[model samples]
Target: MILILVDALRRDHVGTYGYHQPTTPFIDELGARGVVFEDALSQAPQTLNSTASLFTSRHFPLLLWGVEHDPIPGVADDRREQWARTPRLAAANLTVAEVLSAAGYQTVALFNNPHQHATSGFSQGFDSARLLDRDAGQAYARVDSLTTAFLDWHSGRDPERAYFAYLHLMEPHNPYRPPAEYQALFPPGSGRHLYANGPPPPGFTGSDLETMTALYDAEIRFLDDGLRRLVGELELRTDLEKTLIIITADHGDELLDHGGLGHGKTVELELLRIPMIMTGGPVGPHAGTRVEALVRNIDLAPTIVEMAGLDEPGDFQGRSLVPLIDGAEPAIEPPEISYAWIAELRSLTSAEWHCMRDLANGRLTLYHRSEDPRGTLDVAGERPEIAELCLAALDRLEAEGEEARRTAEALKTVETDGAITPENAAVLEQLKALGYVEE
Candidate 1:
């Protein structure tokens, strides 16, 4: 099983997703040969928080904030407490890698982002998990080096053992510098900004937006080329009929879609909507199919587990998407809810409307998705019934998440404490340099 997650990849930017640009030819072909979920929503808009939810099949509060922080063994008390408050993947959380490892699979995480360091609990279950540093500035690791590293690792591992490799690439992220050739694909006029330092400057102009979009698409193309290389190599090495390759993203970037230039800020559709495609191997019958039923990134863990024919853990909250992959209808019409704890923002998406709620001030913003996809207009006052329904669902979700968190806290097993280590300081530098955090 090969699961790859591209950081900050917008769903609409892909060619298969109806974007006019050819930003993702490889991804489009992969989707055409796979089962694509038309409305796959992420659990959060940030990497750490969203990926935590992805690996655990849980909601936001349970995965992000509700876990208790403890002191690290080697770190000082006062300094560690503040760093402890940083979001983490708690040991009490059971990861998909851990389950796969226990099932005799060689689980490896050849990742890119600095946010996924060993101290962050992002490496909990993998037999070998480390940050691949074929550095691409703000984009971190180049997908090419990461793919090469995976091939090397696979060649050395026992071939008889079933393996599960999780590769996280940090491309199409920020400081959008694709390879020179790909960068030339969408050469911008000298008048507009191309986001050299980090994100687009505040109050950026419309020309700047177009320029940034071009740069973003070029970065996406760079990643797509890497995907083509990886797939080609994988096909040469493994049997195409027995290789299960899954591709998705943690979250998407904001490019003035809703008056923003970065993510971890809102649960807007542009930020939450991601591509979840399962191709090759067991997806044979359902290949080239598309499922319009709404799904969340949280379902990924369960789906992977089900594909492996393993029993789902009791704490796993998401239902297996295997039925949907097999052309069966979803068991329920669950609302897609995403949380942005940094912004204290949450959104509930249904078939009819999309609702964003600011938890701090209790303000509800409603948007008719079909009418106003960008969500520029707030119809909360005009459509009280829909807003009320969305708010009620969010309330229930929060309650459930809180209760689950409390249970985990009371009956926790592992002891992963936070510390302000030298490594963490370096990681903070990377995240800050990449516009992921404040100074």
Candidate 2:
């Protein structure tokens, strides 16, 4: 199984998602041969929380905020030590790698995202795991290096053994700087200064937004070319038909949408909506199929586990998508609820509407997604019934998540004291440099 996770990749920016720009031709072609989920969302808008949920098949709040005891009760909220006290994925939780590895599949991971590095407990189940250097600067580990590492690692492995390889590409992230060739793909302009120090300067004009977006698109194109090369290597080295390939993003980015330059600050659609496409290996006859039902990133791990003919872990909160891939109705319909949590902001999205709550200020806003996909129009006052229903749903979800979290905590044999090691300090420094964690 090959899982390729692109960081901060917006769904609408891709060609398959109806964007006019040809930024992702390789991904578009892959979508044509796979099943596409029309509405897929990440559990959180930030990499740390979202990627944790993706691997554990649990919500971010449950993972980070659902501990039995607060590790540092008196520390300031902005302090690094306070954030370090947040819970990591428990050792008891069965990860996708652990399940596959137990089933005799070789598990490997090459991740560029700092949050998924070894210090975060994300490397628990992988037989081999590598993280890019903290000082790699804006581009981090480029796709070329990532692909080369995967190819080299796979070359030494036994060809007959089933294997699962995960690649997290960090291109197209903030401080977007495409190659010289790709920089010329868009109209030449100097927008680098706008986002060089994080976010466009105050009093930024609409034209400035356009220029910055063009730079981001160029980065996308550059990554697209790199993906094409990687796919070529896959075809040359392995049987494409037998390998399960999954392409998706950890979360999406916001470029002046909802008045933000980046993610993790808001639960707008642009930040939560992600692209998910699956092809090969257990997809069966569902080629070129698009399922309109809502899916979450948490569902991917369980689906991959089931596809590998292993039993889904009992603690997994997500259901398998194999039934949908086989052209049959899922025994249980996809849940109407999709959730996103970032610090004090909590969002719940339904089929036609979205509701967000600010836990700090008790502010509530609702958007009719069918009429306003961009979530610019606030209709909370106009549709009080819908808002009330969504709030009730959010309450129920939080209650259930908290209950499950406590259960998991009780099952732990060893309690974590939240001590920071040298490795964790290095990881924190990298995340702060990348603008994911605030210093």
Query: Pick by lDDT: which candidate is best?
Result: 2
TM-score between model 2 and native: 0.86
lDDT of all predictions: 0.77, 0.78
**How close to the true structure is residue 78 of candidate 1, measured as C-alpha lDDT?**
55
Model 2 Cα lDDT, one tens digit per residue, 206-273:
87788778888888888889998998898987778778889899888888877768677888889899
What tens-digit string does per-residue lDDT give for candidate 1 at 1-439?
Answer: 9999999998888887798988888988888988888888888888877888888887742334434554443233554565456656655677899888999999899867766655667788899988765453443668888988998998899989888999998888876777779868877544365453225566678878787788888999999999999989988987866878888998888887776777887778888889888898789778789888778888888888988989898767777888888877654555444443435787877756888888889888999988997789999999998888888888887787666554334322223333445534554455457443445
Q: How does model 2 fare in lDDT?
A: 0.78
In every candidate, how many clashes are there?
0, 0
What's model 1's overall lDDT? Answer: 0.77
What is the Cα root-mean-square deviation between model 2 and the actual structure?
8.1
Q: How high is the lDDT of residue 331 in model 1?
A: 48
Quote the positional error of residue 302 for candidate 1 in Å: 0.8
